[model samples]
Target: MAVVDVALAGRSYRVRVGAGLLDVAHCEAHAFIEPYGMRSIPIVADANAKRLLGERLQASFRSAGHAIDWYEVTPGEGSKSWAELERLTDWLLTRGITRSDHVFALGGGVVGDLVGFACAILKRGCGFVQLPTTLLAQVDSSVGGKTAINASAGKNLIGAFHQPSLVLADTSCLATLPPREMRAGLAEVFKYGLLGDAEFFARVDESSEAILACDDGVLETTIAHCVGMKARIVAEDERETKDARALLNLGHTFGHALEAETGFGDRLLHGEAVALGMVLAARFSARRDLISLADAENVADALARAGLPTEISALGLDCDGAALADHMRHDKKAGGGTIPFILLRKLGEAYVARDVSLADVAAFMDEQLQAH
Candidate 1:
């Protein structure tokens, strides 16, 4: 088992990465969860996850003498909505959850975001544990404490920064993930390398096959490295008050717009959009002469080889560049009449550029959309 400490000043937590961390047969899952002091565990999982892993999870808790009161959420981005949030919060209230009682979010990013946000506002903030069952959640969303749901305005606009008490990423869960979902998660895996760790990026590129094959050693190591990088960044800037945390948004700005254009559904998974968004960021940086064209291609090549879309043109959107840029205007990051972009100075080097022109971005996107 590998542990990465997210050493937030007073509220530090550990992210445990390994196979069977969630299995009570190992006793580790129950041990870490027992201290929370809830006799009957309140767990919220997506419907699909419940169908697949729920029995095992329930048995694990049962073996530790804790009964589970499970809440099932519908799967997909739609679950991260106003209606769902209201429903989940009501359910948690009915369960009599207290600030001291930790709620367990046992599924992928959607389940985590929904439960985390519910815990954030439930009685003005409660504790929760992340049992992230997906690679994207394990390596990125689960550790950061950025809980959010989609609003009429934009994605994650309605959310909060409430860190979890603990995060258990069971690598064994990846075996059940669809190939597309796994590939989408790889975009985030690639982001860590592209934004700050060149060596990690190269390692991912080199071991892409093993990773796709779910090589346990490689997958666990990869997850730990990404979590370690995120832990350092979160500890440094937990509130995005500084540039360190903002660096984690390397491809999010552009990616969110693409997601918005696609209606935030299966049409483009969050990770897939980030993959293309990162490619666009690299290419845009090259256009601005911040990075070389060759470097931009290398970035695209890495993602493309991993089975992610590297071109905006491939999405087949009816709207043009200006429309996509308009979606970004509603982004939560937009302030002071301009949006900040996370552009590459070079591969493994990203910096915020607040001076970015939406019009210029529209034109650049237009060119790409027209490209074959």
Candidate 2:
């Protein structure tokens, strides 16, 4: 197993990545819940994951002598809402879940975020474990402590910074993910390179095929590397108090806008929105003379090669730049009446800039839409 440690002073934890890790009794999973001395454990999972990987996790904890309760949330972004959160919390309460018990998030990013946020407020903050089953969750959402539920205003508008005690990413579970979901997850994996690490970007460029083919070795190595990068950053800045953690939101500002504009439905998956956001960020950097157009094209080309969406026009999205800009205003990074963006200086280097004018962003969005 490949282990990456997220050093958060008092809240440090380990992210274990490996194929078939989920089937090996999951001692780590059991320990995360048991260490808290929680009275009962709630395993929150998507319906599909419940059958695929959740069952194994349940059995693993059961064998470890812990009482396990299970809850199934519908799959997709629609599941992250106040209504769903309230319902899940009610179910937990009905099951006699106490503040002493930890909730186990047993699916992808959505599951992790929702469950983690629910645990954060339930009984003044219960603990939770992250058993991310998707690549996106494994590398991005699962590692970071940013847990949230979506509101009608925007994506992740109502959320909290609740860290998980353990993050277990079993590569084998990814095998059952749909092709589109897999491709969506790659957007986040690619972000680690685009935001910083040109060499990692090049490595991903070379290993794109191997990754898509789901080669166990390549997948394990890729996940470990991404997790390592995130762990170090999270350790340095558990919250976005400093710009250190904001770097992780390289393309998220724009990505979240796109997601919100589409109502966080299937119109564009989070990864698809992120992929396009990266392309837009790169292009905007070049348009502003911060980076060469060639570099921007390289970013787009790399995303294209990875089978990710490289343009907004192709998505058949109904909104225009003005609408997208409106959505940007609702982004979490929007503070003091300005949306902070993490723009690239070049491949493998990104900097947060609040000075980016909305007009400039709008013009770039218009150009991208026209190009498509």
Candidate 3:
């Protein structure tokens, strides 16, 4: 087991990475909630996750002398809506949940994002534990303090920066994940390599099979390495004030736009959208001569090899480059007239650039769609 510390001044917490940590007699969750002096806990889980690891977590927390209440949201991207948040909060209040209580988000990115944001605004603010079940959530969303909910305007338009008290990433939970979901998660794993650590990206190239196979050792190493990378970056810049943390959004700008254009529904999972977004970012960088054409090809190849979507047209999306670019303008990262995009200089090196003209982005996207 490896423990990575997310140093955030007075609110620092540890991310414990290991296999079977969830079944180890309150190993991870206890260490996190005990410090908060919380006795009552409300667990917000997705239906699929509840069918898988929810019982074990509930049993462990109950056995640890904490009163437990559970809430299950339907599994999918649609669950991150204001209506769902309101319903869950009402459920909690009916159960007599107070600000002193904590919430345990026990699912993938959607569950973590919605539940974390719910806890953030519930009675002002409350502690929450991130027991990220999916690979995407474990390595990315679970570690970052950015919690959000989707609105009529766009995805993640309404949210807060509420940090989790602890993050428990049990590799075992990924065993039952569908192949598509596993592939979706690989996008974030690739993002870590693209954003920083060229060496890590190389390792991912070599270990893509072992990772997708859910090999315990490889999975453990990959999750801890990514967590450590994010922990260091987030500790230094919690609110993304500096560009330090924006690197984490290497493919997110384009990714979020695709999600919004697609209605933020099951048509595209967040990770899948990011997978395509990364390839587009790489291609756009190449178009600008920031990187070579080979770099763009390499990114596309890596994502395709990992079984993730590498082209927008391949997703069966009916939208065009102009429509997609229109969604980008509404992005929270958009400022003054340009959307800040994290583009790669090469694998493992990413930087935010606000100078990218929307016309060029649309043209590049059109080229990819035509090629597909």
Candidate 4:
């Protein structure tokens, strides 16, 4: 088992990563909850995760004489909405969960975001634990404090930065993840390298197949590497006030718009949209002369080789560039009416480019669409 500690002022936590960490979580939870007088825990899990390993987790807890009140939601982006939030909060309140008790998010990113946000606003802020089951959640949202629900206007427009009390990422849990989701999560792993670590990216890109094949050593190393990078960034800029944390949103500006355009449905998963958005950002960088065209193609090729989307042409959205750009206005990065996009100066370096005009983005997207 590998343990990485996120040292945040006033709120530090450990991110435990390894195979078969799920059983360990049960033991730890028993120690924490039993003496604390919290006999039952409200576990908000997604359908898929529950079907796969829910019984095992529950049985482990049950063996220790812990009661689990399981609340399940259907998987996917659609679950992150105002209606679901309201329902979950109401259910949790009915279960008598207070700030003193901890709520558990035991699924992928959607469940983490939803449960975290619910805990954030519930009773003026309750504590929650993250049990990230999918690869995307393990690598990205589970460790970050950025909890949110989708608004009608955009993706993640409404959110709060409420750090989790604990994060348990079991690589073994990823065995149950669908192929598409596994590939989508790899896009985020690619983001870590593209944004900051050239050497790491090179090694992973060279070993893409082995990593995709779920080699335990490579999988653990890849997840730990991404988590390490994120832990440092979050420590430096937990709220993204500095440019350090914002760099994490390497392709989010365009990607969120793509998600909104698709109504946050199965048409485009968050990681898939992000993979496509990274290509767009890379191309836009090339257009701005910040990076060479060959560099942009290289980024696109790496994403494609990982079985992720790298183009906007195949999405077949009926919207135009102007419409796509309009959705970006509601982005969390938009401040003072000027949107900031994370563009790369080179393969391993990224900086916030806020001066890029929306008209320009729309036009470039149109060009990309027409080309396809």
Candidate 5:
């Protein structure tokens, strides 16, 4: 129902957000899918998404005379690996996928990242479309050009800057998501408000219940707003050459470490880790007098009310601050021994903080660990 454009000259694309957008036409599918004029479409999805949306999507595309060659991976962050990438590419090659064809990634962030990266390196470079099924993917990762697979050293350390040819965020697909996954997606939605719009945060705070319930209007507006903001930043600094796009990694520096420590499993979903990380970042900001304690508590409360973790201690991991901070040292944001954290100045005002000492981060994590 709404479109957000990421104008980057040659690489420009649009993010379409709406309920049942997978079947939408005129502005999107008509141009992208119709022009291919092929009977088959190459699609990659996680097991869960493929099971849930595969039949419906296949039927829709088939009705348009386009058959889908479905490729599936096990659904999880673990699928973002070298082995999976190699397996996926080999499958594509066996199927005769070429640079002239468009690949469709039809799942959450994991599927999007994996397929996007595969497309980026497949035959040097190929175009891909993102049919993101999760809220986290729709509002964040699906829009950004950051395609990656996890490395042994850390998460997202190996990848490329391949942008999607188109992003179709069908809110209808979200209806099949479990409560935990839905709540996790809400964390990224919350991040959009936290990082930019004070009024949006207030609206989200007031409408948390309705939003979680997936009211169509709320979902559309919420995802569209976040996508629009990201479109602006991606257009301004597509490669993160400046600090403009860096602000998008609001809690990622802390969150990625949590992900690495947990072995990137169901123990902590990426969005849940981001929820905890945002709280940590907020609390750390408050400790530095960058923001008030009240504001930080508000951030924690918002995420907690959405059924997300707000404290590292709650996970009961057998690790300490030193251990967690050590994992952070592998974060891509760090440079020359300094880790640049996305910290808040206030509710809706985030900045990159390069002055944070790892020792202090460890101490803070220690305090959090000991608190509960």
Candidate 6:
């Protein structure tokens, strides 16, 4: 088992990453949840996750003499809406969840985000535990306190910074994840390396096959490394006060725009969008003479080899560059009417470019849209 501590001032927490950490026979898993000390614990999961792993998870908790009050939400980005938030908050209120009691979020990013936001506002903020079942959640979203839902303006536009009390990333649950989701999750896994760690990026580039195959050792090590990197960044910039935390959004600026264009649904998973977004960021960096064209191509090749779309042309969108760049104008990172781009200085080095012109981004999008 590997443990990474997110040392936020006066609000620190632990992210435990390992296989079978949520299994019934895992004594450590039991010990971790046992401390919450609730007889009837409230857990929120997506309908798909509940159907797949809910029985096993419930059994694990039941053995310890606890009953689970499970609440199920539809899977996907749509659940992160005002209506769903209202429903979840109402349910938590009916369960009599106090700030001291922890609500277990037992699914992927959607569940984690929705539940975390609900807990944040419930009775002036309550505690919650993240039992992330998806690879994306375990590696990135689950560790950060950036809980949010999409709004009419942009993705994660309506949200809060409420950290979880504990995050138990049981890699075993990933075994049940669909292949597409697993691939989508890889985009985030690679982002950690592309942002700060060149050595880690090299590892992913070399072992992309082993990772896609779910080699146990590779998977565990990869997840722990990503979590550790994220934990450190979150601890350093808990509220995005500095550029450090924003660095974590390496591919998000463009990725979120793609999501909005695709209607934030099954058409383009968040991670898949990020994969293409990162490729675009790399290529755009090269265009600005920040990095070599070979390096940008290498980034695109790595992701494309892993079955992610690296070209905007592949999306078959009906819109053009100006249309796509229009979506970015509403990005949450935009300030004073200027949208910042997370461009690559080189492979494994990303920086925020607040001075980027939206017109330049539009021209770049036009070029990518026509790329072969």
Error at 14, model 2, angstroms: 0.9
Model 5 Cα lDDT, one tens digit per residue, 138-220? 99999978999998999999999999889989988888899899899888888888988888988877887887788889889
The lDDT per prediction is 0.89, 0.85, 0.84, 0.89, 0.88, 0.87
Query: Model 3, 15-98: lDDT tens per residue?
Result: 888888777636556554564444466788889998988778777866776665678999987898889999988887786666
Please give the RMSD to the true structure for each candidate, in Å: 1.4, 1.8, 1.9, 1.2, 1.5, 1.7
Give candidate 4 misplaced runs (Cα > 4 Å): 35-38
Model 4 weakest lDDT span, ten residues long: 29-38
Q: Considering lDDT, where higher is better, how would the candidates rank from best to worst?
A: 1, 4, 5, 6, 2, 3
Q: What TM-score would every model get versus the actual structure? A: 0.97, 0.95, 0.95, 0.98, 0.97, 0.96
Candidate 1, 1-372: lDDT as tens digits = 789999988899889998887774326555445754545678999888888888888888877777888899988999999999999999888877778788889899999999999999999999988999888999999998999999877899999999998898889988878899899998899999999989999999998878888888999999999999999999999989888989899889989999999999999999999998999999999999999999999998998899989988989999989999999999887788989899998788899899999999999999999987
Model 4 whole-model lDDT (C-alpha atoms): 0.89
Taking all chains together, the TM-score of candidate 5 against the true structure is 0.97
Global Cα lDDT for candidate 1: 0.89
Q: What's the number of clashes in each of the models?
A: 0, 2, 0, 0, 0, 0
Compose the digit string of candidate 6's lDDT tens values, residues 1-372: 888899988888888888877764224445445655755778899898889888888888888787789999999999999999999999989877777788889899999999999999999999888989898999999887999988987799999999998888888888888889999999999999999998899898788788778776888899999999988888888888778889988888888889998999999999999999899899889999999999999999889888988988989988888888998888877778777788888788888888888899899999888889
Clashing pairs in 1: none
**Which segments of model 6 are wrong by more than 4 Å?**
24-39
Give the per-residue lDDT digits (tens) of candidate 2, residues 161-268: 999988888888888899889999998989999887889989988898888778889999999999999988888888788898899998888888888877798888
lDDT at position 140, candidate 2 = 91
lDDT of 6: 0.87
The clash number for model 3 is: 0
